[model samples]
Target chain A: MQVVVPFAAETPKTRLRSVLSAAERSRFARAMLADVLEALARTGHDLTVVATSPLSSDDDLVGVPSTVRVEVDDRPLTDAVDARLPRRGRTGEPVAVVMADLALATPESLEGLFGPDADVVIAPGRGGGTNALVVRHPDFRADYHGASYLDHRAAANGVGASLETIDSFRLGTDIDEPADLVEVLIHGTGRSPECLRALGFELERTDGRVDTERSLDSTSADSRSR
Target chain B: MQVVVPFAAETPKTRLRSVLSAAERSRFARAMLADVLEALARTGHDLTVVATSPLSSDDDLVGVPSTVRVEVDDRPLTDAVDARLPRRGRTGEPVAVVMADLALATPESLEGLFGPDADVVIAPGRGGGTNALVVRHPDFRADYHGASYLDHRAAANGVGASLETIDSFRLGTDIDEPADLVEVLIHGTGRSPECLRALGFELERTDGRVDTERSLDSTSADSRSR
Candidate 1:
């Protein structure tokens, strides 16, 4: 299966401002990207990183394998995905879109995603967003906006494409808000959490909410590491 | 308005089994009940704690004032709420069903709730359950089950009860699972979090998810307090 990860590169993870500075948000976004890429790379599929902007010189993709390709597109998510997919490809293979912020996504979920032999296979996010989806039919294109899952289903029905939905908790959880950091730290054990911990961020009870805060003890103890 | 809290006292907070033991679950449930009761009591409305079983003599409702009444009922949640509402009470006054786990619910939210002159007003939980609802029309009743919010809306429509939904984050935060505890710690300053902290519970990032764990440092450092 040909996989494409629609990543917002230049202006990443603005919703995380409550717990992270702009630089920290960028760093955490990259870390999440690295984690998602590593997971996708392990599946041994031909993948592409469709970024919103040109990659910087210092912004290296650490865990991404050489098998993955990179493309830059400045359009919205739906347009970006639509622009990438071919109406008719070599041997008529299927294309799948995986979100880069899905830090908990595993190879097992990806395996299940491709197992369904439908013209269109969708994985919906918890908050009404289309998280990951696979399209085999040429006429089927993604519409990734508010409640895009429904829009995609309509498009599939209009094109007479058989549709299937993949149920995955890990895939369903998308890191979009400050509250979502708790989900990443709890359900993941990868580059993202490691990066946060490295930056002295620890899960602490802030007032009454579970939040990420800089651990003063860690900062002093690991001053030399910085 | 008559406020009826449909509480599952016997099987309280079984969903919290992931992090808390059975005894801890009961204690935490009671603390949440107390918090809800306290919030409701502040509204100066005649309130009743409709219990699934006998509220234990030792179940000292710490913050619950004297105005609240406790009644034992073994029926289902929907039935317990129905049985408690007076047929022809003071000036055909409306009745409300408030879930006891809404620890973050405030007096202001309750004020806004009663202020609305509607046949049926609902405050929906994050996970689709009806957290708190006010039923003015005597013909209207409650259906507290999976996606009860939808059920309530349908019921309201069926009976021609003008439906109103309260949009408050505080009213929506109902503690149901281990992850829900993080919400309690972050959004509320009630007996629930206090009891959890008193029990040595603290927010910790286990693997990658936000989780409640006993503070080992507190156990040693503040041994005398315990």
Candidate 2:
């Protein structure tokens, strides 16, 4: 099977601007992408990354030992995925698309995902985005606007393809809101956490919330300690 | 309005056992209840706590300064809610059941929730549980089991009562999982975070996720520092 991981390095993680600077967002986005790559690398699938920009280094970018491909597509996700992914009838092997920020994704979950009997499998996000999906129907095109899972189900039905939705905590979470950082810190099993620590974000209990606490000096001190 | 807040204090927060000891759970539960009480205190509504066990201290449990009442009811959530909530025909004022752990809840959110025109208003949890609800129709009784939001909707339709679902993050979140602590810590403006900190819980970034970190020595140090 072929797997596609998309990265929009151009204007990455705009929602995180409240917590992360532009440079920090880019670095963190890449770190999350690397983690996803590492998990996918263990799955033994033919892997490809559809990128909005070029990668800076292979050191953090884990890939399958012998096979991995990188392609640049600046279009929106739906257009990029539809244009890049192989149609179902063209190949016997299925095509899977995984969101780059799934830091908690594991090989076992991917196994269950790929093992489904349905023609289309959707790993739904908390807010209706399709976090990861395996498309088996040739005519099915991904629609990733608001509540895209429902739209994808309709698209699959248009082709008479059986659809299955996986309710997974790891797959359901995709970092978007400032509040979402807490989930990644607690549930992500990837380099994302390591990057956050490096960025000097520390957890502190405040008046009524568990808050990320950091100072400019703390960032420098943490980096120096590392 | 007669507002009921249910507390299963006898077997409170069983889901939090993985992260907290029994004594710690009780303390945290009381702290959360206090915060909820604090918020509800601002609404100028008649409030009652239907408790599974008698509360030893009502001083810290902020209620309407002059009119908050506590009633002990050992029944399960659905039964206790049905019995305690004011029936529509008996009372001209609307009735609401607010979760005890809504540390992030504010007077404004409650105002918006109570201000809705629906006969039934459901504040849903991350899981299938119902966090808080407002009942305007005499026929509406809260069913808070698995996927209770859907069940409540059906009940509303059965009674021909208009139903609306409130989508506030503060209203939707009820601390249930170890990972859920992050929400309470990041968004909660309650005594729960203070209690958690006193228990030596702190935030730390690790390999793949952000975690609530605690140490035996830190607990001692924190207590001393206080």
Candidate 3:
């Protein structure tokens, strides 16, 4: 099985710009990618990282213990992933595509997406995106866009492929917004949480929903002591 | 296409005993079944209501306009439903099994399950149950207990069936507990809400989560006026 992780390297985490600076967002995106890579590494499958921009060996892929083959495909998500999808009705091997921003993903959840008996296994994201999927049928292709989970289902139907949808909370939480940072703080077991805390983010409950608030106490503690 | 609705008519909605008496629960169950039958009637599929006990035409099938074939199966859910599943590789027609307590289900949501082009179309419940499913493949069978949605996914894999899971909030909410009554009041457009309202249930919000509270005002207003 070949696993592909599609990353938006050049302009990643644009939704987090309200809370994270340009450099911080870049670093945060890499932290999330590292967490995803760590989980996929435990599965012992061939890993590939498809980045929109070229990644640095000394920076982006640093600290990832697995041997990840990085491919530079600056194209949009749908085209880049579709190009990597084995041409319909040709290959016998199954290919998996996992998003780079699933900060809460674990080996257990990835196993659900990989070990299913169908021709296509889909783990749908909370926001109607296809966070992770394994394509086993040779006729199936990837289509990533608005409500891509539904599109993928229809695509599987189009190719007459057997499909299974895995309902997993961890694989569903993609870190894309300032509010989404709180999930990493609450459920994350990787470098993504440490990276967010270093940037001064903390969990706060507002109107009965868990949200993130930057702690001013970190900077103001010294001034108050004086 | 054959749409089979498995109903527990003999001992139904036992979980809602805290808020409803035995007689009220039976009436409420019948009301929900009527709503579901109405929705299925609009889809133009052959409807079958498989009840654990025989249904009374004067009471259970009273106001439902659709021609529903009723079957009395005293066995458990898995056995009763599996008995109806077509033998593997023997038939090409699809069989749909929908739970009778999906109080929030609509004709539009049912269209999502019926129109999809897959071997199996599953609508999962919030509590890890399979609320509705359309099995297009002959090898597939029903398994409904202890996270039956997951079991169904594995069953599809076991028999090599293609599957799709639809994400619809209306189709997901099965009215089993007192708390689930709120969804019927909030989103139900059928006889279920009218029956609930007649029983004095009203929507209430607490800590930003919607809940249900029986209205004492209707009875107390008459006493207060005197």
Candidate 4:
């Protein structure tokens, strides 16, 4: 099975600047890519990252292992996935769509959504959003925008696809605020270019206040969101 | 109050080959120095790192702030602190002896040990050793050698000095073994030259399957002896 992570390289449309600084945004995108790649490597999945913005380049994806394929689609995140589905399906492999902002996503969470029996797998975010979606077949299509969890479920139901919901905090805590940076600094597992960047922000603000208890709180919050 | 961190530039007694590979040891040392300087800056401390080995140069302590003083003692860790205490006491300043090997030691832990009324403050290592010691006056001589915690307490009793002990995991977990590297990676706290040198050992031997929980369990076990 191949995991496809569709990442929008542009800034988010929301007015949540208080939560996500420029450094945080860049870190979030980079961290998601690193985590997904590491997770896929750990789980023996052929990983493909589809960048939805023209700004994302091969150079920007440094530290990513050379084995992973990178594809650029200058269209909306959902449409890019839709266009690539048929080509990926030719290989007869399952596909997974992961967002580029989840700082806490782990391999265990990805593996849970990637079981062979499931036709569709959805990992929901804290704010009723879907951070990860997997389709076992090429015919699967979902409108992955605006309350994407419900949209994914509706799409799965319409196509008569067997749907599975996975609850995972590591796959749910997307960095969108200063507090989110704190959470990541305190409790995140593994390291990435993005996670390191986020850590710089965290250190600048918190000045090393991250303790075992704070780390536990961050991990628990991430797990609860899932 | 000024914080004095005494470091031995040449650790001839410590075996580097067993603990860290050559590449890892150098990297670990550089990273540790960087982190210490950064942490001191963040905490607004009057930081002075006294190098007890004659090999150290003024340029080696770069990145440490101008306000922070750097001195070369060319003596043992204990003897260096004993020699420097009189000059500090002449200025009516209390001196705190912080060992550089405690990877998780932070400025907050330092502040917690600083008590105006206490004549001696000691941070006991998990291995029943002293990682940090603070003395209000230089005249109160105490031998800091093997199993120093008991020796320090006994010396404090002899001098009629008020002794204070602060049990902190951050202060307790010193980097000594390959297993301890996992805890540093998981906790995201504490960095040592020795620990940094062990990073490659962690990367190669563990292949990223570092059992942080197990490492912490070991830490707790070590702490019981203190």
Q: Spell out the clash pairs found in candidate 3.
A: A89-A138, A162-B162, A163-B162, A163-B163
> Candidate 2 chain B, which ten residues in sequence have the lowest lDDT sum?
B217-226
lDDT of 3 by residue, B23-48 (tens): 77888899999999999898899999
Candidate 3: residue B125 lDDT (0-100): 64
Better of 3 and 4 by TM-score: 3
| Cα lDDT tens digits for candidate 2, B125-203 | 5534567888888877777765576578888999899988664556766776566675565446668888888787765
> Residue B144 CA error for candidate 1 (Å)?
22
lDDT of 4 by residue, B180-205 (tens): 55435533344443343234322222
Expressed as tens digits, the lDDT of each residue in A55-132 for candidate 1 is 655655765666778888989888999876658654577888999998877777678777899999987664345778
Candidate 3 falls in which docking quality class? incorrect
CAPRI accuracy category, model 2: incorrect
Taking every candidate in turn, the Cα RMSD to the unseen true structure, in Å, is 18.3, 17.4, 14.2, 20.8
Name the runs in model 3 displaced over 4 angstroms: A88-90, A217-226, B1-226
Q: How far in Å is the alpha carbon of B162 misplaced in model 4? A: 0.6
Lowest lDDT 10-residue stretch of candidate 3 chain A? A217-226
The TM-score, computed over Cα atoms with residue i paired to residue i, of candidate 1 is: 0.51
Candidate 3 Cα deviation (angstroms), residue A221: 18
Estimated TM-score per prediction?
0.51, 0.52, 0.52, 0.42
List candidate 4 stretches off by more than 4 Å. A1-226, B54-59, B86-89, B189-226
- In CAPRI terms, where does candidate 1 land? incorrect
Tens-digit lDDT track of model 4 for A35-88: 667666777777777775553565456556667777777687778877655344
Of 1 and 3, the candidate ranking higher by DockQ: 3
